[model samples]
Target chain A: MRRNRALLILLAVAFGAAFLKAGSFPGVAAFVPAPATHIAATTAHVESRFASSKLHTQVHAASAIELKDGTVRAFWFSGSREGAADVTIHSAVFDPQLGRWGKETVVASRESTQHGLHRYVSKVGNPVPARTADGRLWLYYVTVSLGGWAGSSITAISSDDEGLSWSAPRRLITSPFANISTLVKGAPFLYADGTLGLPVYHESFSKFAELLRLDRHGTVIDKQRLAAGGQGSLQPVLLVQDAQRATVLTRYSGSEAPRRARTMSTQDGGQHWSAPVASALPNPDAALSAVVLADGRWLAALNNQQAGRDSLSLMLSADQGASWRVVQVLEDQRGQAAACEPRIDAALRQSDLAVAHAAPEVYAGYRDSARVKVQSGGACNFEFSYPYLIQTRAGDFHLLYTWNRVFIKHLHFDTAWIEQRLREAAP
Target chain B: MMAYTDLTGLAGVAFALGVMLSRLPLISRFAVARSWLVAGIMALALLPVSDLSLAGYVRGVSGDLSVTSLLLLGLTLLSRAHPQRQGLLLLVAGAALALYPAAMGLGSFDPYRLGYGGYAALAALLLLALWHWVRGNGLIVLGLALAVSAWALGGYESANLWDYLIDPWVAIHALFALGRAGLAALKRRGGAR
Candidate 1:
């Protein structure tokens, strides 16, 4: 009888506990915070490594554009790294009206024995496709023939029918290796006289940004250095307002303290530039991108953190690359608590103090959950880096950034969203 | 706060009841009963308010299994044998797996990010434990506890060897519960026979 009473008490306790647990279900609903009120204005789609054929792997350094009939076209390189024997240029188009990316087509590969040189070319890098001022669509990309990224040459293929077909790839012969200077980050600026200003960069032992001028018939007339010296800067993005005055934002590659962003200005139609100055931004020695806003502002995508790439930030500069105000934080992964304690415990068990010291650095670098910095009024200290921005005709900003090297995140927002937030802050 | 409040209340009640029940010799007598108690403990650990219950929190800290899912799955299948075979297979597989990161000079890719969110880590760990249990090593019970403790602590960088050895996954808990329940059902039927 006494045992039965004890059993009854135990049953009562279990029932009571389960009742309370089930009652707590409402609490689970409260943990999820409210979603963002404004939707992103710009939409970004990733053209991953194998958007085309599986037979040939290795795809990187991509550029895209949205055509007049709402067709989005993208171009990239495929082969075996930067200097393998099987490198080739590939292109794809996205028909937005039909809501599908077109079939992947090969644009250029190694020339046949009848048409070209004997040595095997390994890979290609950095493809730039643009519509010229005369309505001719031009595709300019690099092919590496001999060495690493240093022994690369730029070539062009034109399509008069908006990429349905293309002319044979022709070597530009832009550099000293008879066409072997790395010509990348090509953005065409249409001069008042209908000429083209191509922003190119060299990446031998001395990495420098240069501006090349070409006639309408794809003839290279002249060129000049935008920023010189071996600061390891490449990808000079040009923002030209008129024929004479322009600004070029170059990605910093040097590994020194207070990492600088090289910038220059042309006052004489791609003739001369002011000495490149390091901007007040921290770069962990990686490539960066920038684009001009329609309102005459500049948007830069880069790693804002001093040491790691965990924080990718997007900044808007009213003055050309001088000072930047962070518009948004794309990714900010904080560390987890559950996994940290036992790792510390294991370190203690092993009595390895050295490994323990390095553990925190490893934890900080690998933690995937990131926080977006939204609180305003002070200079944005949050990390927002490696940004690529494109402004649409509908006045929306489309931005894409590498989210901790795990995935690429696309952020789209409009001027109205910024204006609305600013108006709300005025009170 | 209410979610946390409910979670703490439920956990406190369950823990207090478990402690009280465990004091009674009758409840502790049977292995099947003890296994049920373990299931209850796992459910308690999953309270929404607990740090281990968050999806992104776990994945970021624990890593993902997407890249090595096939390999882990294969190991899971191989370990489901008799106790001696299970132990041997686990040792061989564990040694190979542990050395793979170092040998390839490949840094730890967070496997927690790979699969469906929320229960991925729990599932992977449980599957691993099930493989151990089927081999009848009986060390799976201890492993389950260690794994849960490691996961609860957020698997952070500390001076502890236990963190690297165990991981909390749903499959581990479910497998333990299922295996114990299956054994209990078999014994009951056999007694009748």
Candidate 2:
């Protein structure tokens, strides 16, 4: 009789503890902050071009941010080749008045990352620099410890004085198994409470996009997968309509039948997402950038082709991505201003075959000509891809993209330019 | 934060050492043999041979173990009990053999997804917890305690539920323990011939 009484007491305590735990904490609700209400100086069409990276090395996948001091800082990885040991993250500050980019600063290296992680690092790539709500700049990049890109980890470094100095690098615990295979590409958005929502992809065995919700200190708080299982999609670009509604445009990765850019939406601020459906924009398995403009419209820069990066264009969507139309042909392959030297033809099976087979002299010519084009401000026709867009407080859109895999071309324009282009393309 | 994460794995190594030392005749003489064994392991984590402690090296091999694994060790050590259930051991073995290879890119259908808002894994864990309770084992209670504490304190670096429940080291150790027990049982049955 005493033992039975003890057992009843134990059960009561267990049930009581569970009840307390289940009732104490509340769920995360969608909290959307109000948009900025300030007006810019003007809405006229104004564009300025500059090459942020001056290195002749293989440069790609650049991200940028406009500082509080009115300086535009751009960052990308440059090395002898992609995933090379000598690969380092390079940064440059753009002087808006002088209309030129400063000398590149070698910010992060493989040695520094290995030292911080206390593990052997094989290579590094894809540095994404962004300004937090508190005015500090945080840079996140990928580092491979073993195997291919599937064995990669994300590391972070913060800068208080813009891109001048940085804090010690620390690895973000993104995965359970040695933290491998997770890669970041899209620009990180934020919640109303200063939480960062970074879009990451898994490429180990599955190609899908996941939104990692992190605290202000970069600790991952939660994760929600945007795409799962089937139709291979990755590198999602998030566009926020408000606090409760957002859309992710993912680059379709189906090689056999490359179709339009796939899209998914979240009605509850990224907590839940709809199944990814193909949108009305073609993709060639390349990185793209999308943003929700201040005027309640959507803008995206993507390779509008079925299977090649030979063409890139700007598309506008006014009906919340339900329909889209090409506002401007940013780069055209059939035009006379197409990239000439590294010509992709019928014999070239791989899309990056031209880059693989191009001679040093050919790459040098493309680099030198791209530098000249940035200065002279003419048509940009050389393999301009991997575009990242950011709108500043002055209502100007800053675009940073890879130019022929040798330079990071910075293009600053306004919404008026997009409006004019849409008018010209209309019937 | 990284140092804290590295040191948390010492709990796993310490428990493993304590379990081994408890089997020795000389060490088991003291009434507090298990406590002394755990204390010695804790000393190894704190003692600096030159500059780094032994905890650093052990953590490198056994990444960051789950809180559930650590709590299970504590429960066993405190109660001086061992639950020998073939069903639970087989479940752990199946998870180890299945997840380790797939995570290393062996096959498709990543079980890692089951950690991120996947319902099937949570359902299975619930069923397992119910089974443990019905069998009068303390593992379910300990698992619940660890899961609650980790969730409240944001214990592990990963936000995944699987990372909070199982890690590679825990899975492999469980498999090895089960394999050793099976071999010993086979020898007693004269199955080796």
Candidate 3:
């Protein structure tokens, strides 16, 4: 009995150590290398009619691409609140030479749903756009039909002449539930074979992640799941190193403890995935955004606090996601709000702020605080919101998150800032 | 590295710690006290009844199946039964509790997955072993069979049957309750002698 008890103690210690080591939270360094010299460049410029309108509410999940004419065009969904009927896909263009953003244009609207979904839309969400290798830009967004968010479908539109005009919206029927299971989050990855791997998830009895492959023209080809059953892994973020191998990271939303960030790998070009294993990241049931940096590192923006969005941080991971070093507090509550203006000015001094000139017109929209009522169990309290990320060609990062229920605050920064901070940390 | 801070994971850690604490030599001497203490900690860890305000709609969704609540309710019923019957009753009750989550899901509702994290699986196995050690009380064994049936029949609409039928919280409650009943039976037998 004594020997048995001693063995149990040993086993318990070993188990505890293993769990702690697997999480790897305590000892990782939280600093990065600062740049030797800082040369600021205007990484992003927001030019949209919604920016100055009372109808302007929330701008979220934006994707930006630089056109052949040196014009940077950004596409994102703006609505009264996230996943609302007023939510529509909007766009603006930035002319690098002019150093200004141009007028905003509506790409997809609730009226567009009447043509595509064959039903009056109740809400729209999560617009993600990508510029194909052939220069055609494709936009993907979600539209709900009957029930709550679970009853949704993905729709796509293409712009051949950049942001000047777009193809009429069409539904991409990707799920067995007609369209209920498909929702896009991350920027669509253009596979080497020219197929688009759009990250999506199902909200049925089983909330699992899927990689929906589409043709270059935005036709659904094949679908694959990231994890099996109801482990609640959704919002898959693709980390592409090359064509043959890729890693898909997802957020865990099940009743499982530790609510980890689940990760799986694919070698056969995303046809199948290895079983998802837990990563050492903490997820408190909030959305996360990740982008692959030019240097092969990854930048992930997430709420660092255990519970609220009060402390949003930008973290850099040099070794895939095995470890992370903090880049900076992008939007912590403690920083001086006045510091924002100077920071913008300082960044602009080092970099040229791209702006575009467009013919101004009379933009008409209502600005009423409508007390909209929702069904019994849906999210009701309405407000504008934003949470999006995009990586520019010049190795800079552009982020857009909601600034209260007001305007969408756009932030632009580069590797130089990160390197500078890392150098400052060096003793 | 990723940072996680949810009670679900903490519950597993607490269960591991409770298991370690219960096996310690010094703590083992005060078996009843140790059992209650371990049960209390496990209950606190598993159910965020205290944080109901913060958990909001999710708390209402998960309901309550804490270790202390299950063990205390089981012991209260066993105290009224005959000594031999009390042990049988504890075993039966534990099996019911362990199997309840797996068969019914977390509560009588949501069952797409197991309700009580990974601990439920361990708990179920432990109860099954205890039922076997008791030489198989016919009714207790019948209860186990019924729990298994509930698990099988629950289906997609039934949540995951494994979690419904057997869970760690249920197993812990059963073992501790059975232990208490066995001690009571032994004392009665000794007195008669």
Name the candidate that leads on TM-score.
2
Judged by DockQ relative to the true structure, which candidate is superior, 1 or 3? 3
Q: Please give the distance, in angstroms, between residue B23's alpha carbon in candidate 3 and its true position after superposition.
A: 73
Ranking by lDDT: 2, 3, 1
RMSD of 2: 7.7
Tell me how each candidate scores on DockQ against the true complex.
0.01, 0.19, 0.02
User: What value of lDDT does candidate 2 attain over all alpha carbons?
Assistant: 0.68
lDDT of each: 0.49, 0.68, 0.54
Model 2, runs deviating above 4 Å: A1-26, A31-50, A131-135, A256-258, A333-382, B9-62, B67-88, B91-136, B139-156, B159-161, B172-193
Q: Is candidate 1 or candidate 3 better by TM-score?
A: 3
Tens digits of per-residue lDDT, candidate 2, A165-284, equal 998777776666767677888888767777677888877766777777667777665666677644677888888888788888998886545487888988886767888888878887
Instruction: Provide the TM-score for each candidate, comma-separated.
Output: 0.49, 0.75, 0.53
| Best-to-worst DockQ order | 2, 3, 1
Tens digit of per-residue lDDT, candidate 1, span A244-332: 56777777777767776666776765544687777766667655676666556777777776575556666678876678777655455
Model 3 segments beyond 4 Å from truth?
Answer: A1-56, A96-99, A334-387, B1-193
Report, to 2 decimal places, the DockQ of model 2: 0.19
Can you tell me the DockQ of model 1? 0.01
